[model samples]
Target chain A: MGMHLRACFALAVALGAANSAIAETRLDTDALQLEVLAGSCANCHGTDGRMVGAVPALAGRSAEQLEARLLAFKHEENTGATIMDRIAKGYTDEELATLADYFSHLPATAELTP
Target chain B: MSQPWNRLSRRQLLKGLGGASALPLLGAMPSLAIGGQHAGHVVVVGGGFGGATAAKYLKRANPAIKVTLVEPAEVFYTCPFSNLFLGGLRDMRSIAHNYDELRQRYGVDVIHALAEDIDADAHKVRLSTGDTLRYDRLVLSPGVDMRWDALDGYDEAAAEKAPHAWKAGHQTTLLKQQLEAMEDGGTFIIVAPDNPYRCPPGPYERAGMVAHYFKEHKPNSKVLILDAKDNFSKQGLFTAGWQRLYGDRIEWVGLSNDGRVTRVDADNLEVETEFGTRHRADVLNVIPPQKAGWIADRAGVTDSSGWVPVKPDTFESQQVSDIYVVGDATVAAPMPKSGFCANAQAKVVAAAIASSLEQQPAPTAYWANTCYSLVGPNYGISVAGVYRVTDGAIAEVPGAGGVSPADAPDTVRALEAEYAVGWYNAICQDTWGTQV
Candidate 1:
């Protein structure tokens, strides 16, 4: 999955947008999409956007600031980023906004420990 | 496999769920709070990534909904970082996780037993311990079992000789021992399976990791990949990484190149290719074709393909009701059967079940998969995608989730290697409530 991934990705976005319009009615498309999307970030950002170690905590962060950073990463402008930029590009602006708002509301707890 | 659950007598059925003996196992679950939101009980089979995540997320989604996780193991060893162990980057201790957090903190009843049977209609699951647990819903992350009889001369017996090590447990240790005992300059042959196997990038990453070991310990040793597939995920990145790190120490033989292994010999540690060519190995690792776990078949969720076909959004079994199948046992194409996908799918299934029990709207599902493979201990590559239920099946969101740039700097590869470990820790911690 080298250029093959990028090549297929460039073509699929159009079909995805077109299908979203039709799939939205049957699949609860617009409602609570952020729920699962935000949870997925827990793999790196920690559960509910809380961090356990060196990675920054997403919990209780400012929504506006978080969204701005996500947008920058998505746009490949986050100079200090690692895989976040790659992961961020997979999200839309609206999805990024929803994630930021969702995490911002989570109580900023201490670093997670098992 | 025998369908023992189907022959449950009328008396056993009555005793399994109705008898007073089952109440003790119920503990806090069967409270008669009828019409209350999230008052149902969930029985999750398997304690690996999917089942463990489902159990934890079920509790998180609704604390009132009782969750009983049925797993045979007390300590769960993860497949995600097992490769690092094989490469000598990490040890087995760092790959083990337990259910303490899920049980103590999340209030999940962790049952250490094999889930032997699933009477879907009766909403009952029979355990190997001769106990039957009743549930309002079931989540199965049972994972895959090797198709023991798929290849000729390759069965349970052959595995002991040339272990698959597909499931990260004792088999992992066995393979490591064989590798350690292998003579310098000996060949380590990895038999890669066909398409649609668990972790598409796994076999290649394994080749890279093993080559790393050979480079340091046995520079004269060769790592040969006899693949059933002609093309593979991240081929460019892996080939480049191999050349840069191990020179000509690693080699790949694609299916078209007569690399598809059709049989194996445990006594001699050898395998035969499709072209009737027999290749001897100092140590053989066969990642045989796989099917859904045995319990999935017993539950009647699997089709002729021996894999469960799940509804795209909720991962509900297309063939059965009240049971959701996740992880490697599922036919989730475009989204590879990696631990990341299972964890993501479990969240959606948990939300769907919680919403149904509480009479809420179905939550929209979005799945993201990022699979990282270590080329060398410090050299890593990845493929990622964002998916949703579109066109009535799970399809990747376009323009999102791509592989590492083919020409990325070595610094980027090294950094990705670090993030790969970070991703593993965060996900394992998030799922099992502990970072190993």
Candidate 2:
């Protein structure tokens, strides 16, 4: 029984090691974080930044333009009445740049339309 | 100025944690991707914020995956901005959304039918229409159900007399009517439920809205709040706002001060508290304690707390395989049961499902929630948070999000109120694909 338990433990460790190796090779952490940061904008900006109302859509803009706008909000220079100014302040400059790049690459039009 | 992107590398940060590799572990599993096809059928129950967003994203994530959304209601009334309607700042049609866009625009098979039973083992769902449908993966966003027995003498029958108005539609209209029918100098009582209820700031916001209505229509009327908890979400901001806007019109009694309602007499419109103090009011709004919806309980996914336990990364039920639970039905701690939270969780689960179906490494999951509440027509406040899955649990990232600043300028408050309306339109558009 002890030998059987040891064999099971060994198999689990082996599987864990194999998974770690695969993840290190396959997962792109940079792309994942950028997606996470950009996805947060969807709460008020519409999904993938295709906003329909007064709130401006963030998709399909130049990365430089998006980065400049976010930086302005973050620095409280172009402060808005809403929470965007405060929300922008929460992210680092690097994170803002990543979000800009990510949203800039998404299709400007709604992707879900038939 | 753009800062360099590699300030804090997620890979280097997660390197020490060997468990970070669980993403690929999920990839190695046998694809539930069935029938010799690259795509699989994903059935979503409950077409609220969670289910609707999931269905849309599932199709977007993998055009091959067939998505079916089962919802009993044709038009959905959101609880987020319904308080504004009650306050007379907006109309009912503004908060209502239909499934036309989600159906025609997203190619989702939107079925307006009741989901009766879930056969987890067979991956089949039995609908009220006497038809059974199969799914490779099932998503349940059943929201919440009021515990009728939680408050003595307060049940569905009594709720008809004094509406809870927690669920949006008829109950909301009923509460609005009651407020309108109230006499000039009447007393309005709001009974808030215990911890872990839907939308923590909801009852307080309702109080604000009612007070606003009274101030405009019946200046002599007063609003009383009997709370089950001493401290509430955004308490400082709410109390401060109440003092400024409604003055003495709104009064709050906490649990510590014998404020918890023990029983109710709907006929007399009287509520008896823990100290046996019976207070009679012209109108009473009782929000009872809640649990996972009836379907979740029937599916045997709920634990003792009456909420489904799920893996933080994927929102897959810990009790049942291939079955994911989202929204207020799941035990997503540190994350309040709010519409925004539900939408955020749906995106994470959709991405995970897509990666699994497509035989790719699952992306690391992160979620964010922001809830905006209007104290009055021109007064607004909000709370926001960013969360990540760590050590098999959801944890709020430090210094990521916070409540609206206390004692802000009137201009800031007014701007938040306008943004609140904009947020409602944006979220509705995102969820239902409707142009609000």
Clashing pairs in 1: A1-B234, A49-A59
lDDT (Cα, tens digit) per residue for candidate 2, span B56-75:
77766554467889999998
Candidate 2, DockQ score (0 to 1): 0.18
Model 1 achieves a DockQ score of 0.21
Best by DockQ: 1
lDDT of 1 by residue, B1-436 (tens): 0111221122233333444332333332233233233358899999988999988777665555778999999988988878778888888989999999888777789999999999999999999999999989899998999998888889998899899989998999999999999999999999999977888998889899899999889989999999998999999999999999999999999999999999899899889999998899999999999999999999999999999999887899999998999999999998899999999999899888877775665577878888989999788788888887888989988777888889888898998897787788788887897644
- TM-score on alpha carbons, each prediction: 0.87, 0.85
**Residue B84 lDDT, candidate 2, scale 0-100:** 84
* Runs in model 2 lying further than 4 Å from the true structure: A1-37, A52-54, A68-82, A85-93, A107-114, B1-38
Angstrom error of the Cα, residue A98, model 2: value is 1.8
Per-candidate clashes, comma-separated? 2, 0
